[model samples]
Target: MPKLLMIAGLVLLLVGMAWQFIGRLPGDFVFKKGNVTFYFPIVTSIIVSVVLSVIFYFIGRFR
Candidate 1:
C-alpha cells in the first residue's frame, strides 16, 4: 500500500473509535456486592478494528 493510503487508513481507524466513544465513555468500576468483579473497556473497539481491517484489505487488493 502507498504511504498516503496507509496513513489515511490509520487516521480513519482512530477517527472511528474516537467518534463513537470519545467523552461519552464510562469509567471502569467493580461490583463486590456478590463477590464478583469485572473490568473492560465499556466502549467496544471491535467495530473500529473491523472497519480498519476491511479498508486495509481492500487497499491491499487494489495495490
Candidate 2:
C-alpha cells in the first residue's frame, strides 16, 4: 500500500510539473462565447484512465 501510494504521488508530481507543456490535448472540447469560456479534457481523461489501468494491472500481477 505504501509503495503504491508513493508511486501515485510521484506520478502526480510529474504530471503537475509537465502540465504547462501538455496544455490541452487533441479532441478536448473548448467553448467560447463573448467573455465566457469552458474547457473539457475528454481525451486527456481517457489517456489518464488507460495509463492508470495498465499501472494497476501490473501492480496487481506482481502482488
Candidate 3:
C-alpha cells in the first residue's frame, strides 16, 4: 500500500510537470462564442489511455 501510494505520487508529480504540454496537443478541441466556451481533449485522452494501458500491461505481465 505504501509503495502504491509512493508510485502514485510520483506519477502525479510527473503529470503536473507535463500538464501544459499535454493540454495543447493536436486533436484537442476548444471553442468560444461570446461568453460560452467548450473544451474537449480527445487526443489527450487517447494518448493518456495508450500510455497507461502499456504501463499496466507490463505490470500485469510481471505479476
Candidate 4:
C-alpha cells in the first residue's frame, strides 16, 4: 500500500512537471469562439489510460 502510494505520487509529480509539454499533444483539441474557449485532451487521456493500465498490469503480475 505504501509503495503503491509512493509510486502514484511519483507518477503524479512527473506528470505535473511535464504538463507544459504534454498539454499540447497532437490529436488534442482546442476551440475558440467570440468570447469563449473549449478544450479537450482526448489523446492525452488515451495515452494516460494506456500507461496506467500497463503499470497496474505489471504491479499486479509481480505481486
- lDDT (CA) for every model shown? 0.65, 0.84, 0.78, 0.85
Q: Which candidate is the best by TM-score?
A: 4
lDDT of 1 by residue, 1-63 (tens): 489777797777877767666543455344555666565544445545676788779867997
Which numbered prediction scores highest in lDDT against the true structure? 4
> What TM-score does prediction 1 earn?
0.43
Q: How do the residues 1-63 of candidate 2 rate in per-residue lDDT, one tens digit apiece?
A: 898899889878876776667789999999999999999999887877787788779878988
Clash-forming residue pairs, model 3? none
Error of 3 at 49 (Å): 1.3
Give the lDDT of residue 30 in candidate 4: 95
lDDT of 4 at 1: 90
lDDT preference between candidates 1 and 4, better one? 4
Residue pairs of candidate 2 with colliding backbone atoms: none
List RMSD in Å for every model shown: 5.7, 1.7, 1.6, 1.4
Where model 2 places Cα greater than 4 Å from the true spot, the runs are none
Q: Per-residue lDDT of 18-63 in model 4, one digit per residue for the tens?
A: 6767777889899999999999989988988888788889978998
**lDDT (C-alpha) at residue 55 in model 2:** 77
Order the candidates by lDDT, highest first — what do you get? 4, 2, 3, 1
lDDT for residue 37 in candidate 3, whole number 0-100: 89
Q: Is candidate 2 or candidate 4 better by TM-score?
A: 4
lDDT of 4: 0.85
How far is 27's C-alpha from truth in model 4 (Å)? 1.3
